[model samples]
Structures are given as structure tokens and as C-alpha cells.
Target: MPAQSANSTSPAADRPPAARDTDALLRAELGTAIRKLRKERGLTLVQLAERAALSHPFLSQLERGLTRPSMPSLHRIARALGTTQQVLMAAAAVPHPDIPVGSAHLVRSGEGLPVARPGGTARMLGAPAYSVHPVEYTGMSEEFQDYYDHPGDEFVYVMTGEVEIELQAAEGPRVHVLGPGDSICYPGGTPHRWRAVGDGSLVRLLTVQNATGEADRHHS
Candidate 1:
């Protein structure tokens, strides 16, 4: 059996130093974001969990950064908080300084905001206020099974390792395996799933998503 990096729900002590740090930072950022949103909505933890249909203790752990939630769970929480996952992600990142409407922004390497994932880490590489949201996912495991369907145009580029992507397109379900340097782009509202494909070594990919669709949906 291939050795797994760490538990999907919690960080492992034996993980590489960098991975562990990423995990910890992601957890803390996510927790803080959730808590802040909940408070801003004037809802208590119990009320928010009830609305999200999640366990109260689980939400508590999430707020404490002791545990991480799956994509579906995070989506549920986001909806309950009257926001989208992308907006929540923006909140999770280091607060962007208020720049003028037409000014350019820069994000240095390793300065991107960390995002929690099941068996790996994802960083938000785009400025929070940008119209394009770029994220880098690293060390994704084979067990990753988050399927997404939302309003946005998404482009994916494989950086290292192999990835098997399953897309529910207009014609039918399509599965594609991508290697280094491969890329794919699809419109929003297409259900899709992707995971690392190999000896469980982990994979890295960069995804750039246009925020127009999601932003429209958010305000509508």
C-alpha cells in the first residue's frame, strides 16, 4: 500500500516541515474566516451549524483550526453564511490592502494565502480583489474526491505528477488524464472531479478561474 502523507481531517506530525506548516496555516486561516463571517452574520456557532446541517462539534473544531472540512461541507457552510466559497477564500487570505480601483497588485512567491484541502494544500495566488482567481494546489492525494459545479470559467494546468479529471460535459461524462504541461479549460456549471493518479506520490496543478460568473451569481 502506498503511504499516505497525513489524515484528511487532521495534520500529521510526521509530514514534511513545509507541508505541516501549510496545513496549520490553512486551518487557522479557514477557522478565522468562518468565525468572522459567522459573527458578522450575527449567528452563534450552534445556529450556523444548524443552518449548514453540520455537526456543532465539527464546526467548533473547524473554528478552532483543529480540523478541516471537505469541499462539500465548506460549500454548505459558505451558503449558510450567505456567501460563496470564493468570497470565503478571499476572507481567509491575508487581508488585502485597500488599493485604488485602477492600481496594479502583486503577490510575491510564498505570500499567497493558504487554503485547506483534504490531503494537501492549496494557495490563493491571485490578489483578493482581482477579477481572476488563481490557485495553486500541491501534493493532492489520490483520495481527493471533491466534485464542483458552479458558475465560473476554470482553466487547469498540470505542473507535476499526473491527474485524472472527470467532467460532466454537455455531451456526456468525459474523463481525461493529464500529465506535466497539460492543460484544460471548461466553462462554469459543468460538474467536475479531479485527483492525483500515480503511486500516491502527490500532484500539483494551477487553476485560474474567472470571477465574472460567480460574482454575478453571488449578487443575483
Candidate 2:
């Protein structure tokens, strides 16, 4: 066959008009989904823009489907919304491969969790309640305490070494010493401080409170 010209139409050009319409619909749906999620979170456009490190005008345009955001921008927005890019992309009607039973990707805490505090490594194994996090506490030269109050609760199970947990209570500070195989449950709203005892690193598996409740149901 003779060489085809660069401007020649390919087989893709023969696709039905519905296919093109579907793509446009997906793009619009993705934008609308993100905007709805932001509104549900009670975050203003400016607040979300600041969190995503995007300009207000650009974010507004994105929410309106007036502009297509780059992958990085999408990633930032997903992070701000406490979700993954895969979820956001799916909202756009993009099909993703199903995760194999034994091949689920491991998300590193150092990469995903935005630790506002210093010291120790906190990794999230799943979506808060459905996950476990391995927190490794090294030498405590600096007092690391960051006040974070979220909606849910957690149970800390000490795997190795000793951990001192100080909960801020109405009466006074409540201190608890936990060792290997020992776990403690406390309200997530309570401000707390953690320190590794001795010079060794202390490892703990922090289970989500909701999961703990489910486990309790099975045992009870």
C-alpha cells in the first residue's frame, strides 16, 4: 500500500458521536463531583484553593469545567479533599483496573499522611477506621506534641518497647504506660502527648476506633 499522508483520517475518526459526548460528559461530571464534595465539606472556594495551593480563579474555573487541570493540580485537589486521584478520576467516568486480592498497593505514611507534628513516623494502612498505622518513635530529644482533633477515635496498641501517653483531661493530665501487646483507647477529641520510653524505638499499631468497636462486637 502507498504511504498514508500525515493528515489522513485514522480509524478513531470513525467513532460514534455518542463516544465524544460521553467524554465531554465525563469531564463535566468530574468537575461537578469535585465541586459538590468541596461544598459538602463546608469549605469555601478560597479555602479549598489555599489548601490545594491553587489560585481562586483557577480553582473556580476548574469547578465550572471551564478548564482542565493537570495531573499535579488534580492530585493536590484530591489530597485536600482527603481522597485519592484514582477516586477523582473515576468520578470522571474513567475506568480503573480492579485491585487484586494480594496485590493491593501499600501506601506509605511518609508519603501520604501530612504530619503537622514533628518526630516519629506515622503511616496509614487504610481509610482511618478500616486501617492500621505503624508508628515508629525514635529517640525523644524534642518534645513533640501537636494538637489535632478529628471526628473519629483510635486505639493505640504497643508492639515493642514502652510508650507514655498523656491525655489532657478536665481534672488533670492522665498518663498511661503501655508495653508490647498492651493497647489503650481514648477519645479522639482529647489532646494528647506521646513519648518513647528508654533509648529504643517504640512501635505501635494504632487501630481506628470504629474497627475496635466492630472487633468488640465479635468478641462480645
Task: Tell me the spans in candidate 1 whose CA falls farther than 4 Å from its real position.
Answer: 1-44, 58-72, 95-105, 213-220
TM-score of each: 0.69, 0.44
Model 2 agreement with the true structure over 40-70: per-residue lDDT tens digits: 6789988888887777777776677555554
Error of 1 at 183 (Å): 1.0
- Model 1 residue pairs with clashes: none
Which candidate should be chosen as best, given TM-score against the real structure?
1
lDDT of all predictions, in order shown?
A: 0.71, 0.52
What does each candidate score in C-alpha RMSD?
6.3, 15.5
Q: Cα lDDT for residue 184, model 1?
A: 99
- CA shift at 119, candidate 1, in angstroms? 3.0
